[model samples]
Target: MRTPPNEAVATDTVDEGAGPERTCVLSRVVRPKDALVRLALGPDGQVAPDVRARAPGRGAWIGVDRRTVDEANAKGRLKGALSRAFKTQALEIPSDLGERIETALRQHALDRLGLEARGGMLVNGAERVEAAARQGKVHLLIHAADAGADGRRKLDQAWRVGGGGPAGLEFPEPRTILSMALGRENVVHIALTDAAAARRVLSAIARWRAFIDPDAGLDGGDAAGPDAGEQIRHEGNA
Candidate 1:
């Protein structure tokens, strides 16, 4: 589908200062490009997710959650919207598009973690994380989904005393996935020491987790106050 240059479709460009904005073709809501998922039309007429928004050609953005997209797809509303946006009804949208999007988002978040790890901005292992958390050197705290309850609480307390937050964000995946992402063994927890790196990682993770279930909490404690990761939700998110 060849969209005209003057069409309403969003481009893959990112503005340097305030960031590029895009409109959700379905919801008609304007939001930052990073806060929405992009759907790229391939040469074979297949509509695939461009999670990083770097795919060539024009793309359609969606701000709704996964369930909403699935519902719209089932009712043909999503196809109609895409047909209008791309000006072509020959596009093929997989029945499992929601699952594909979720998978892409999960991988993107893990990739962000791996990048930060390689850059030496984060520390893993319970002991190291706890020590750093106690000293206020930790900018972000994270725990595996299956991490022990007592262990999480201990780390949470330490982070709080060190001027962190009430609790750390819980990764959607278990320790095995997280271990592989950071190239570590039996990794149950992580502490990012750099503020910028922490924000980058959390931004990636928030989109992934929010898409799966918007009402779900990202952390495993009393969410009475805002944590470092929680701030991403309010930072121009839909």
Candidate 2:
């Protein structure tokens, strides 16, 4: 079931100097750039998602939630919104805008992970991650969606023992996706030893999660639900 949109709720606190705030054309709520998805009209008269928020020219910013996009598409609100936002009625709204945005978000997160890996800030493999956790060198722990319960518990315990690392974060992508991202064979667990890299990866993941599931708390608390880990295990087993 699709979660209902919380466009009326102001869940995010404004961060000064983070960037210029943009108003969601659908909900009329002003929020930081991180909390919104930017859409730009191309020269071909087609609208495309600018997930990186780097597209040139005027752009329409929408709240970071799938429901927002779905609703706008369903009610033909996007056409009107784009026309007003860009001051053009010739723009074309793609039927798969939502799906494209989702794919872009997933790719963006994976790309960030790949960059972190290249920077030597990320360590993979269960044993290596556990060792980093034990040494208190891990600033963030990332567990693949399909990671086994035993492996996850082992590293969780190690992180607890180390006592300074943040709680283990479960990536929504499976082990295969994680492996491909880091150019590894079978990545089930990863540790971010550098604080800056961890924050960058976390920010990317948070933006994707917020777009897919707005209810997810991006601050390491109940990303999906109270039983997110259990749900992941169940899905993996299935």
Candidate 3:
């Protein structure tokens, strides 16, 4: 999951190299930063995810799910904090705050992809995956690793045009990632990104992949999360 800095500290720690652990507000225990998303009430009094964590104002941190937030809201933790920070009791938390945040984050991620493309991040089409494989230009395969057999075959035909990946490469649903990340459309042919973005994307996929993989670890991940490295092989297909 993509988490902002620690929420327990309740402030932006974007460049804080305090090592892997930070404190959680709800639990009051230091934990991995990856476990939370920083949220701050905007000027309009709407709660949103602080993706960049640069928003000015006193921020409150929380895990990136609705249940925890709902719990905090019920208990008035957020209410008290807001009352103290803005020095007023007249504020509103949107009824659909979680959905709102999800939508915003998704849009931001998609925008970043466009920004990357505008900045010269290449996104090779179906045919280029093969070429990328032979020339080692391929850093990732952005296909629906779980698509139907015929769809996979057709895509693979185009995918192997250049020396693409191996015979049995797999992928994930580009649209799903787009929806989750709030992008333009399905992200079927994404190129590799910088280490930071790539790590975040890959980790998010791990949780998704674990849901469908029968062999997922207890933590519900397979590391890179069902990328092309693992291809399906039937008894007679070689």
TM-score of each: 0.87, 0.82, 0.54
Task: Rank by lDDT, highest first.
Answer: 1, 2, 3
Across 110-193, the per-residue lDDT of candidate 1 in tens digits comes to 999998899999999889999988887887788899999899999988887777766787888999999999998998999988
Residue pairs whose backbone atoms clash in candidate 1: none
Give the distance in Å from residue 115's predicted Cα in candidate 3 to where it truly belongs.
1.7
The residue-by-residue lDDT of candidate 3 on 1-238, one tens digit each, is 1112211111011213323554545655554444345567777876666644578986655443455556666778756655564566767866665555555444444555445455554454444444543343433344443434564455444434423332222333345654344333444445432323433333333322332342543122323322333322111100
Q: Determine which window of 10 residues in candidate 1 has minimal summed lDDT.
A: 1-10
Model 1 per-residue lDDT at 124? 91
> What would the TM-score be for candidate 1 when compared with the true structure?
0.87
Local accuracy of candidate 2 as per-residue lDDT tens digits, 48-68: 988787888889988748878
Candidate 2: Cα lDDT at 37: 76
Model 1 has an lDDT value of: 0.77
What is the Å distance of residue 237 in model 3 from its true position? 43
Per-residue error (Å), model 2, residue 70? 1.4
Candidates 1 and 2, the one with greater lDDT: 1
